[model samples]
Target: MKTLGRVLTAMITPFHADGSVDFDGAVALANHLLDNGSDGIVVCGTTGESPTIANEDKLTLFRRIVDVCGDKGSIIANTGSNDTLRSVEFTKQAAATGVDAVMAVVPYYNKPNQKGLYAHFKAIAEATTLPIIVYNVPGRTGGKIIPATIEQLHRDFPNIAAVKEASGDVNVASEIYRRIPTDFMIYSGDDGLTLPILAVGGCGIISVAAHVVGKDLNEMIQAFERGEVTKAREIHARLLPIFDAMFVTTNPIPVKYAVRRLGLPAGPFHLPMCEPSEEEAAVIDAALKMIK
Candidate 1:
């Protein structure tokens, strides 16, 4: 399977002040990220507040971004959930929305074993012709899809294209790299590990900080590909603080605040999530300055 572009923003969902999904703001942010430097956009992923968003809203958002971006970049949707049947159903619906692909995460909370993991993903893949990007963020999803299972899925399904690796274990990523086919894609789900993952044969990143520093992140990837390893390291070091700040609170809180702070259309976070603390806000502000 072929890969999407290197730098994909796990984009944040922009909201209205009243907590409604801000469709216009989302379109604007999608355009903004692509124009700035992101090669693709992953809508409704963890960063996009998928937990709070309704299914209808996700379909609507997918349509808006696909309509705006057209063939310019990949507009991938997050259709994964704890329920395999629900994931399969949503994946088909998302494919109908004209997104380039759909990402089904490792089922969180249910904590499926490797066998269950492979079965869950295989079911989703079988239901849709759209390429599947299997997300394995153990921090978010309690189970880890080991390399053997991932390789098995890949061997079984041609449409099972990539994995968003956020296990925060470089060794696990390295093992995946060593075992999987060279053509199979492995993307760093964490921003700070982009360069390290690349050094170990991972392809690129699906990033949060890219919402703010996408140009730098894209440049870092290009630099590494060009054999300018030192320059890539410098870019990574320069970006470290912003990456840390975005997660200072739970994701989307700091990032949503960061977007609004930059005067973008990002409104506010939804319930069960709120604005960053004064100190966290200060840290985010300072981190934004490093790039500015």
Candidate 2:
């Protein structure tokens, strides 16, 4: 089991022209994230278009990323699905594939109550030995994983290793942290909120912005770790424009587009996530330039 310490890059899935999984491209990106100094890679997460990727494709990509990362770092497979049983199955599938951890988001669209939430994750926690990072992104999942409930979960379960605090509620996470044991880690679910989350004692970020600006993201955490809050804040503010652009659209839309623009073999975005309008692409272009 990898001790996830700093920034973990929530990877952007690269597609081919035919919309098939770009296995080679995915491996290349994983290698880039590591070489650029990402602490780990969160494969098949929201940024990776998990909704569209099939089970077989996910297994292939997971193995490919693991093969590419090669013990240099860790891999957090996102197994968050609306179906608890299916999520458990996927988590086990990923664990069997040898991922360091599995990140499962709260039930989406079908918004479950705390009791249902506990049941959902409680089942998955029972199913896999891979460390579970409970993902609570109500902005996307349509329900919150309340702080009090999370504390109860941490208390009851030993493998519930981390919480990806993307609920945009720093207090909620801080309260959970104050309650839970120190071994349980908290990763900022929002790329833009890394420093704030870290300031409030978050360990790292499962970052979308890291898709483009990998090393700089790591530096933000390192600076803060070294007691250079001013430098960390400086880097965070400078990178704010990049972070802003990442969420400008519905995530990977802008991220992949920017990658394609950078001359990577990034392919067209799949449906339900169609190409951004010319205006939006222009904004992304400007944002990429700003980072340059």
Candidate 3:
């Protein structure tokens, strides 16, 4: 199985002023991230506003980003959703795009039981030859894929290589670490919990804060790996403000604003997702001042 690297940015989808997907901007952003500290890019995940992007646009992004950054670093496509059949078909399509891997989020809204969750991921894993990262963010998904379920899936599918544990509960992550094989990876799906998750044997993070602070985040992870616990803690403390800022408003809103402020190719947000409020922008600005 292939490793998708330690720090994967859950990248945002850049847009044109007219609300169209900005393919050129995406290529630029992908290169920018790889040049910084991102080991891979997870395009069209929650941070990318996947709910709003069209399927054809997502496929285009998967192909285009892979073409541009495939050799430079990993390019992971988010092809999973609440629907099983659609996820299976999309995972196949995304795999054909030459992306290094695919991420399937825990099915949301319908709140499937553990058995259903197992079946859901089992079908996705069986569909493709690419490595699979099972995303488990119960806060958004309205349900949780307990550790036993995750362990079962990992045991059943060799291709189900990792789980992005975003439950925000360290005990849960610790339990998962104790249950799974050491070779099976666990990633922090939440930026704020990266270090704690790492302490409990998480591999790295599928991060949002990485857009502005990738180098610093990577340094922290490396510091931990080298047993420089003090240095890692210091970096995490310094980054806490930026981490807090990114979520001052709902996810991609503040993060998209931060990316635009950096003079990158990030553009306007689609409907239902809009610009940050003035108060939220102020908080984000205060936090961004800490970068560099």
Candidate 4:
């Protein structure tokens, strides 16, 4: 089993002034993250406004990012949807785009049971040769892919390679890590718990905060790996406020704003997603001041 390295930024989808997906802006953003510290880029995850983007657009986005950074950094494509059939199709298409791996989120809104979750991912896993990262963000999906089910999938499919544990329960993540093989990777899907997850034997993170603070996040991971617990904890502590702020609103809003605030190519939010509220904006502004 291969690892997608430790500090991947679940990057935001940059837009043009008119709100169209900005391919140039995306190439620039991918390059910028690589230049800063990101080892990989999750191109169309929640932080990239995946729910709002069209299938054709996502394919274009995936192809473009792969074209730009597939060699430089691992390029992961978020191809999961609530519909298994659609996710299967998307995963195959995404694999064709040359991404290093595809992240299949636990089916949202439909709330599948463990058996159903197993089958849903099982079908997708069977459909493609690309390595899969099972995303379990129950807060958003209203369903959890429990540790046992993950173990089952891991046993059943070699391509079902990793889990993005965003359930916010460190114990649950720890249990999953203990059950899986050392090569079967587990990454914290939440930014706030990156160090906590690492302490519990997690491999790394699929991070939203890395968009704004890639270098620090990467340094924190390296510090921990080098047995510098105090240094890693300190970096984690210093980054907490910004991590807290990036999520001040629902994801991508505050983060997209943060990227824009730094004079990056992040353009504007799509509808159903919008700009941060004034209070939230103030919170974000206050938080960003800590970075430099």
TM-score between candidate 1 and the true structure: 0.98
Tens digits of per-residue lDDT for model 4, 176-247: 888985778889999999999998879899999988889999999999999999999999999999989988
CA lDDT, candidate 1, residue 237: 91
Which tens-of-lDDT digit does each residue in 151-202 have in candidate 2? Answer: 8787788798899998887887788778873877988989888899888768
Q: Which residue segments of model 4 deviate by more than 4 Å?
A: none
* Residue ranges of candidate 1 with Cα displaced over 4 Å: none
> Can you write out model 3's per-residue Cα lDDT over 1-292, one digit (the tens) per residue?
2358889999999999999999999999999999999999999999999999999999999999998888988899999999999999999998989998899999999999998999999999999988899898888999989999888888889789888998889988899889984778789988889999999988899999999999999999999999999999999999999999999989999999999999999999998999998999999998888785
Q: Count the backbone clashes (under 3 Å) in each candidate.
A: 0, 0, 0, 0
Which candidate's lDDT is highest? 3
Q: What lDDT would each prediction earn against the true structure?
A: 0.90, 0.85, 0.92, 0.91
Alpha carbon deviation, residue 275, candidate 3 (Å): 0.8
lDDT of 3: 0.92
